[model samples]
Target: MTELLYLFDDSTECTASVLSCLPTGDGLYAVTLDRTIFHPQGGGQPSDIGTINNVSVVKVVHTPEAVLHLTDHEVAGEVVLKVNSEKRFLHSRLHSAGHIIGLVGDQLSWHATRGNHFPGEARVIFEPQDPASVKLVDCVQFQAQVNQIVTQAFARVLTENNGIRTVTWGNLPAYPCGGTHVKTLNEIGQVEIKKIKLKKGQITVSYALT
Candidate 1:
């Protein structure tokens, strides 16, 4: 099994020396490294896309023993894996945004029935029994307040206790998650809520960063 560097330390970025690489049966290159920072797609989030020695990494897939990097070309020599910083950053931001919506909405007694970070567009669907109590305007206002919390640049703490990785959003929300996230709430910035619908004891809240 490969040691997941990102799990222990999400801040680490590079691995200086890499060992042998092999093509696994699942159409993915099993690149063994002394260390890595790539966060594989798991826990309801998509994988990271970048390059290994300048060759584009098409996708990062999870395996029982190792995280595979499916690259654009067959790699050789002492390989170097580079995760797309922009994509990683954006995904991180969006993931935390989803968590914020989940935490705050839960605090307000609005339970999230389904929540997802859909690459470019992330959303959290809530289920509130009395839909009339929370208006669309209320969602907008709630988003405004979320941005305020984001602006504070709160610190992030990651921990694994009892076999579950927890992503803690500052001081408010502490929940188990395996997805990548920004180190601070300020990175989330201003967000927009949309697609408010009330049906069958549910209130859906969709989100986008503005």
Candidate 2:
């Protein structure tokens, strides 16, 4: 397993040793690092795209064995891995915003089943529950509620224990996750609750950044 540097450190650039570089044809190679700062596509987030020693890293994926970085060149030796800061910041915002929505869902007794933090498609899916026992909130009220939750400073807590990683925001519930996130709730800025809908016993909270 590759040492995931992004978990503990949010730095965009790091130096890594190229473990193996296998050609995947069309002048592309699948490179694996001894450790990496790149976040693989998983946990409702997309892969981090950047450059490895000037070689373009188009995509990153987590195999059962290691994190494979698809690059345009066959690299070797120690090289610098530079994660795209613009895309990373956007992804962090999307992910943190989604988690905040999940936090609100928990307050409403609507635990999140899953979430997608991709840009323009960010939404939280809640488990199906008894409608009679549920209290619904409208989009406007939901946004207000989110504002109430996020306006205060909420320091992010990322912890790893026994190979398991969890993230928490202030007094909110800690969630098992592996994706990247904002360092603080204030970094998430204004969250826009696009819509809140409950249908067929399931609930969906659609959100975006303002």
Candidate 3:
């Protein structure tokens, strides 16, 4: 099994070190590693972009057990892979921000259905149960409180309960989430709810970082 570096009990950069590389096909290779902090394209978040052995990784796809990094060209030696920390941090911030908004909606008696992360130009969409319950004024109030919570520098505690990853936002919202998140809410910084939609008794709230 592959060891996830991010799963470790430490605060460090989200990167990984290559352990061994073996040819898999004519133009493809399977690179194994000791540990990796790269949060692969899972939980609706996109995979990271960066270099591996000086060759740019075109894509990273997550599987059941390992995240495979695919490069444009084949390599022949020990390689160094550096994750785009900017992208990683952006995703982390947006993800946690989404969690905060989602939790707030739930507190308002609005049942959230699903959430997704749009990286680079980060965005989070939340499907609420009662469309009539969502209001522009309350949305503004929710965002203000969310920002305040982020400013508190709350830590994200991940725990395995019943074979699932639990992502707890601060001490307020603790739920099962398999996605990656920033260590603290303060790292998420400021967030804004750009728009909201209503249809079929369902409210959709969209958010962005400013």
Candidate 4:
């Protein structure tokens, strides 16, 4: 298994030894490293695009076996990896904001089923404990609740055991996650609840970063 460097911290660049390199397509290659700072396109977050040994990386795929870095050119031996810091920061902020929304749902006795943290398409899907809670999907009130959670200085805590990583926000609920995130809730900034919809006994809370 490739060492997941981003799971421990948010540093953007790292040097990793290339374990294997193979040609995947026309003038493209899939390179696997001993460790990776690139967060693959999974868990509702987009893949990290950057450079590996100066060759442009088009995609990063997280597979059941290892992380593959798709590059414009071939690379071997020890390689320098650099991720787009701005894009990564935005993705992390969006992801962390989704977690806060999940927390809000939990407080309302709703269980979060899924979430998407991609920019311009961020939202959380929840299964309400009571049908009455479905009526609480107010843009104004829900925004206030989310704002209240955001204003708090909650530190992001990560723990791993037996290869499973768990994330926590201060004394809030802990969740199993494999996605990238900010170090603290403060980095998420302001979250605007765009719309809330209830349909087929499920609630969808759409949001955006301001």
Deviating ranges (above 4 Å) for candidate 4: 131-134
Best by lDDT: 2
lDDT of 1 by residue, 44-94 (tens): 567888777887778777878767777656676666667788888888888
What digit string (tens of lDDT, one per residue) describes model 3 on residues 39-109? 56766677766667667665567777677776667654445667777777887778777788777777666
What's the best-to-worst order under lDDT? 2, 4, 1, 3
User: After superposition, which runs of candidate 3 have C-alpha atoms over 4 Å from their true positions?
Assistant: 9-34, 76-78, 120-137
Flag the better candidate by TM-score, 1 or 2.
2
Higher-lDDT candidate among 3 and 4?
4
Candidate 2, residue 101: lDDT: 86
Task: Determine which window of 10 residues in candidate 3 has minimal summed lDDT.
Answer: 7-16
In lDDT terms, how accurate is model 1?
0.73
What does the lDDT read for residue 36 in candidate 4?
91
Q: Please give each candidate's TM-score.
A: 0.82, 0.93, 0.78, 0.93
What overall lDDT goes with each candidate model? 0.73, 0.88, 0.67, 0.87
